[model samples]
Target chain A: MSKQAPVIAIDAMGGDHGPEVTVPAALDCLRQYPQLQLILVGQDAVLRESLAAHGRSDHPRLRIHHASEVVAMDDLPSRALRNKRDSSMRVALNLVRDGEADACVSAGNTGALMATARFVLKTIPGIDRPAIIVTLPAANGCTHILDMGANVDCSAEHLYQFAVMGYELVRAVENVDSPRVGLLNIGEEEIKGNEQVKQAARLLSSSYLNFIGYVEGDDIFTGQVDIVVTDGFVGNVALKTIEGLARLLGQALREGFQKNLYARLVGLMALPVLRGFKQRFDPRRYNGATLLGLQGIVIKSHGNADRAAFANAIRMALLEIDKAVPERIGERVATIFANGAGIHEDAPHTTRMNRA
Target chain B: MSKQAPVIAIDAMGGDHGPEVTVPAALDCLRQYPQLQLILVGQDAVLRESLAAHGRSDHPRLRIHHASEVVAMDDLPSRALRNKRDSSMRVALNLVRDGEADACVSAGNTGALMATARFVLKTIPGIDRPAIIVTLPAANGCTHILDMGANVDCSAEHLYQFAVMGYELVRAVENVDSPRVGLLNIGEEEIKGNEQVKQAARLLSSSYLNFIGYVEGDDIFTGQVDIVVTDGFVGNVALKTIEGLARLLGQALREGFQKNLYARLVGLMALPVLRGFKQRFDPRRYNGATLLGLQGIVIKSHGNADRAAFANAIRMALLEIDKAVPERIGERVATIFANGAGIHEDAPHTTRMNRA
Candidate 1:
């Protein structure tokens, strides 16, 4: 390619639909972002056939890289790590690690993707573990929720690191000078949550981020905070809970309007408005989950993501690349640890350090 | 007094609205359940005034049981245990413990209520800790979720106890012969969740309950299982997340239809349909969390619950009493532990107990 555009690697042989979605999504993203180059890492014949069907056989900026193996969704992390050396997912990450691409997007097995990314790119210094920060559509616009399914057994220090990393992520991507970050807990009271959560709150209060004291689960969609910090288990549960409820609500709404003739007529009249709401709150729009704390940007798309959803994942990776998120997080975390605040466990709430 | 009815004790001076909501809710529940009796436990003058305002002061079926002190929401559980000897919350549970009331319902401080209940009622044998089990609206019907905000640092055995207790509660209340019980986790795979969850799954599988291997957070609203079990931290976060997302979706729907003149016209036409939808998903309808594993039945209403919501909590308590839920659980748990499963911590998944 002659243009000086950002290159993003794609795991074309990932997800349920594989190339059927990824190849189209990559092409769609290239059309949207003029200064974008794509590297499709998968079996050559499968990608070529799909690209041929899409009538994009020879784009100037698109190149196909062949990979032999694929990681199945149910494959254990250990098995994936040991078995799939030259898999599409591994190859995509390898490209990013080699500085051949600015970012990598994958819709493969979450466990495998996280394991490979952590192993390949390694974590930024002062960051103990990597986190999967997924943004969901909230009352305002969206809220960045971290540790979706990455670190299950997080320490107080690990939680504090998540809060700092999440804070920096929101600031870099959304460009908020001081993003309001809330530690997800059962209640809003200062002394209400579990030990780890309570300790993290104390650590966050001592940091530079605009830390809003313990926000309950409902605060996630209340538009009160830009970022919510939680351990992997709780965050993963909360994110999936949101997705489940959204689908349930949509189905309920549809059935509620189809019961009677009058209701059906009302549904007809309300179609435009409902369509608008659907478009606004579509899960596909928020499909991409950024694998934060890596040396380079890596976007993890939903395993069942469609073309539009996979394209959105590419857009998310592009945004991270443009803002230099990893560097920003590294600098912020260095300051946090340098102050010796994050080094201690269960720091007393009374002696919280204020950002001056 | 003439009727042979179940007597429910209400903590009239608890919760955010105090007697304003509790008194009215008690009256409303009494009105709905013809043979139901209620005891208002609170300060004498306050109870009398609230009862008189509702014009039910002299009703024979309703009586005042005076308690001098009130438990504040922010009061530490330890302080509440040490200081509030005659608080309304404690008095209500005392009625149940003394056999004067079939069940006790409180909209008081959750921690204080849990502490007071455990101290006063103690736990049923074989049950390590009490869980906050609440039901939420789902697709086919409703789903029961436990450990809403109690026992954050749960052992695998504690989680197993919760599952057995929760499973029995569903069978008694819903009358499903063998309720499908799922261990709430981040993924559906056996090796997916954190340590405690995996161990709990093993314990559950060996037991007689229809243990569904692993269910994710989204599965809660899908109505695939009658009971979903998790530690207090994850369950509480999931419950609150549902509430928050429901509120956001409601607001989004309202705003979506009120966009333009035509949209407003369509919204007006769809008011009946929308009202039906709202009624079906009303949070108040799903109010009242049952504190399971206690020797006596203790129902916890949301502290911020209104009249309808608090009344629903009373209804929930009545249902449990009618079903003899605690006694049934007591018997079932005796059998479960008799198999020597409850005592072991981190038991291997394969050595799970068989029905034989």
Candidate 2:
């Protein structure tokens, strides 16, 4: 909307579809915003071909950063970092580090992207392990959940850090001033889950976060809490389960509409409203995946993301830029650690106290 | 359809709704299967009231097993078992132990149910810890995922037991011979998850199970594997997440159909087909929760399950009784530990080797 728009560096060689989807998406973002500055990072020849094919070569603010290689989806994080020095993902991360762009966006290998961001930009001050934040489309707006697959085995300290970081994210994007944070567990009672969740609940409660009591799986979409935090393993499963079920239900709706001529007519008439309702759950509008705890902002788009999804990722990056979330999160975690709140405690110890 | 149906003991004083839903559901089950015998276990006065009001007191096969106490949903597992001696859940478990019923069904407190079953019936011959098996509605049919909140912290041996037990379940119910089993993880690669998942993967590969390597959360509903094994902490979250998403999608669909007159007409015409499709995804039709690795079959229905859901749970109990899943699973686990297959190697040592 403004002339001084933010610039986002995109890894054109990353993701399942790569430049095929990324180039068109970048063009769409530019078309919509009119002022968006995009620095496309990828191989020179391929980038040129894709840009020309989209009739986007003559765009004023569009530029290309020539990087020669790519990190494959299956490439191990550590090995890829050591081996692929000039990869597009790495170069895009460098742009953010060097202050050439406000943020970096990629739909590439999630592990590789997270590793590269941490390796290059490093963790922000007081943030221990960076997390992946997923914004789920809920009946009452989108619910932001964190640590979706970044760190698998987390300490109580790590989870505390994730909650602090996630709280800031929900406030920043959803604009909820006092975001209610819930620890994901098997039951609503504090004592009803494994040691880790109980410990995390204790840490969250003791911190400055507006911590609600333990929340079960069903609570995630109930809008009972604004932010839900967990270890990546549980969070990842929750995210995937939601996606799979949404797809399943959508298919069922289609079949239902196709059953009879009356249904077909009804389906045609209801198409606009159904589309509107579905747009709320489209996932494209909510596809931006944030790598929390990083020194800078990094957003990972879905691998099969289309133009609309990628644009949304750009919009998310802009929101983060506006909120200064990473810095605020860093300050909060530092304050907690400085106070020496609930550290040097075992999982069971925390669990017992929290359950009490 | 048969002349002489199997007998199932019901814990009427269980679940959030208790006799309010359970008694009516039992009556419905008897109606659906005229030959089925019901052994209702609860306080005599309340059961009599519900039965009389429902006009089902005249049936000759309807029997009552009086139980004075009930298991509160939030009671600690250990405390509840030691203190609530005559609880309905405990009495129900005793029926299975006393051989008075072929199988028992409860919608009681899960922890208490698990603790009582373990205490009374004991673990299957060679199993370390009994798992909780719940079927997930998948694209092809359904996949039985084990340890869906029974055993929180699992060992390599525990997962090995779950796989064997889960294999027997799918083979008996789904009729899939040599069912494919997958260890739930963050990625599909052999080395893509946390320490526990990796160790379980290694042991599963060496065992007699049809180990199909690692599976991510998304793959759970694709019907790519017949069984998915994970620790209870993760499995619980996965199951609840799926449940939440299913309910959320259903709500969204209903809301979408009610937007206007056109949409309402579409909804009207699509009702039959939508209902049919929903029947496929309904948790009620698949409402049986098996307490795996037990000496006898004990199924836990949903706490708020209505007549239809409760009937499905009873139906599942009958099928398991006929298949003799308990006896088969016990034999499989016994063979693994008897041969000293993965147990002799030591789990920690395997974990260290795999990590290195």
Candidate 3:
């Protein structure tokens, strides 16, 4: 698979901007990666018009796949799954499921996209559910957090699975021989957190993985761990809270600079430095969230992503395609299960070692 | 209660800095509010030594209440509750329990403080648990979030009770006639969230309170609602994530300004504006988290709070005392129960109106 050029399916009619953003992003990805091929799945006429708007009727690496339906941003996942089989999101996933595309990218309704993808490409063997994993900027380098908004009510066994998946992904992509994985909890104490987290902590502790016990929320940015595993509800809330705070701080900084003439002059002088800081922590730079533990690769871009952010999502899919993350996770899970260290529902929780 | 001067019990031996921070903070509070009386609960000699170090032997408004024990920051709640009866934290709460103080402020182990406060003051009638409520700087004015780190697990009925408590607190303290209440969930859609949040949403919708349905994490800072309610685990994680992101951004901005000679020169000119911006969102201004639903007012300061932040916590306790937060919440709960709008354990989930 690595020998062939990477082929990605784009949900052209998804997200707030639909084909206007995804089409240009698809073209940008093709331009950046000469060996890349993209399948734009949407209404044929709309995609063609978007492509024409970009000064191209057609490209050798790009093909338009007709998808009659488009999932609305407010569509319920179950409704989208049952009704929108011909949706751009579903068609993109179908392309990947049929092995025509190495991966798929979509800036669509997250719930609808997840439902369609899961229905089309089922979870890998020994995996109960697929989790969304995203890389976030940290003090040292970066941190990968899983179950961003996937499974809401994850069991202890499911959290253990997320840990295994996150560990393998970090090891494979970041080239970390032993990625430090931490279970996200309210406190870094052995006795903190609810029953599920405590049980998950026990599972991670007994495993061969480089588990760094319970970590509090602040640890996510402290660069104390490589991967943070959490239930989707907590992870989603944390991620969105970060976004909200970033927005708030950004607004406050802008208002401060525009307060008065002297401050505005000083802000003018500080523009370059502030821009550099902004670029360093730009949400656009970290746009893609991968659906891990699936049989195939699917990257969920932020629904409001512009061309550049959508292109970044495509870049993520290409990287995952090159790394074969799913295959590696499968092998790791298989090895752990064969060693009788995999998730066992009936297994009693045990504390083997203190958290590092 | 309003006619009498407010007397606050202080846990002087709590938090990271102990007497070094609490003593000076208590003194500053005494100086700030002429009618305020403070009781410093700690080792007699240590309190006196701290007071002497601050160029004071005693003040007319300040009194020392010596305790034989100190609760360590790492002490388990159960252990602290079972054995540390003479601990500063317990002694402070005992003062409130015995009506020696109108309220109590502690920068101590949160678990221990909550556990001891619950055991001492007990929950208000019809309130099953006490929740920690903190006011946070938001896009417009400020937003209050409850269950900050109190109950790890919450039922739908418990969440309904939280909504009533939060609504009452915001109304009494912020002076909003109808505070917009929102239940924090993964998404704003009615279909989103786990069973607990969805069930809670139904309860909120049926209530007479200005209950906005489900709210996403980012809504906390959008100033879209006055109160956001969630289980303690999610609330704690969200709050910590905000702190982590803030610290990360502050460091990044500092590093950006110090990158070069030109940047540093611009940074010097930008200092006043930056300082103003920092003051606008300073965490110290929002230091105290009220333990709502308790029979007496209890304020929990950040364990690492310095003098300014601890003083802010005292101010928060004073504000609650002035507004009679606990009394109002108790009355509100009683009214709701009298109207049969209170939590019904076996109430079937009902959706009456679409979320506004």
Quote the chain B TM-score of every prediction.
Answer: 0.92, 0.91, 0.94
Native A-B interface contacts kept, per candidate:
0.81, 0.60, 0.79
Worst 10 residues of 1 chain B by lDDT: B347-356
How displaced is residue A287 in candidate 3, in Å?
0.6
* Model 2's DockQ score: 0.44
Chain A TM-score, cand. 2 = 0.90
Q: State candidate 3's DockQ.
A: 0.57
- Model 2's C-alpha root-mean-square deviation from the true structure amounts to 7.4
Q: In model 2, where do residues sit more than 4 Å from their true spots?
A: A1-5, A188-191, A259-263, A338-356, B1-5, B188-191, B339-356
Candidate 2: pairs in clash:
none
For model 1, residues A1-356, the per-residue Cα lDDT tens digits are 22236789999999999999999999998999888999999999989999999999989999999999999988777778788999999999888877788789999999889888888887876777888898887886989898898888888789878888888888888988998989888762433777887788888788777998888898888889989988888888888888888888899899989999999999998999999899889989998999888778889999999999999999998888777788778677677677664343322111000110
- Look at candidate 3 and tell me the lDDT of residue B132: 88
Best by lDDT: 3
Q: Residue-wise lDDT of candidate 2 within A53-74, one digit each (tens)?
A: 9887767878999999899988
Position B280, candidate 1: lDDT = 84
Candidates' C-alpha lDDT: 0.85, 0.80, 0.87
> Model 2's chain B TM-score?
0.91
Candidate 3 residue spans exceeding 4 A from truth:
A188-191, A338-356, B188-191, B338-356
Report the candidate with higher DockQ, 1 versus 2. Answer: 1
